[model samples]
Target: MDELKLGLDLGAVAEALAAGEITERQAKNASKFINQVKAVHEKPLKARLIQSDRGQFLGEAHPLDCGAWKAYRYGPEFRDGGKVFPSLEDAEQFIING
Candidate 1:
């Protein structure tokens, strides 16, 4: 996986804590902050995003077929039972913009 750039300043947080400008709790919270990261290397579908002439993006179900690109989690049964995209467009936009 590629390293992600988190635009945060650890030194600044340390300085603020040292100067008593921020609580130790706040500094600790800042230090432990996590950014959401998800990989989109696989298709939400069985085919490529731009497969043959029958691209799903152009089908009648285009805008609603979000299972292809949205992130999801499997239950203990490995079922499709976790978070899903609100729409295909939203997922596509996120991938394109990010």
Candidate 2:
């Protein structure tokens, strides 16, 4: 059998959960999988980035950023073409428009 790897973004997964498309257990499973992967890679297990008041960079596409957005329950707007939106309201509008 071929071993195929799959990748999942926690923000996207949380969005699914918030939208009622996925269950809380599913989100937890995803998080567990991510933690296991990090352990294998010898990486720290954190789920949020502290963007300083000046908006400092926390590495390219850090996982904490994902967790922060997920915690904000901003997944629905994010998936509906609002990924680049500067505000959550704007993201919702984008979702309504598109």
Q: Pick the candidate with the highest TM-score.
A: 2
Each prediction's number of clashing residue pairs: 1, 1
What C-alpha lDDT do the candidate models reach, one value each?
Answer: 0.43, 0.45
Candidate 1 global lDDT? 0.43
TM-score each candidate.
Answer: 0.33, 0.34
Which 10 successive residues of model 1 have the least lDDT summed? 34-43
lDDT of 2 by residue, 13-93 (tens): 667678887678777877677667767678664433333346652211123333322222233543432134444444334
Regions more than 4 Å wrong, model 2: 1-5, 43-98
Which residue pairs does candidate 1 place in steric collision? 44-68
| lDDT tens per residue, model 1, 1-98 | 01111435567767778888788887776655522211222434342242224443321112335345443222242243323456655544443332
Looking at candidate 1, what is the lDDT of residue 90?
A: 54
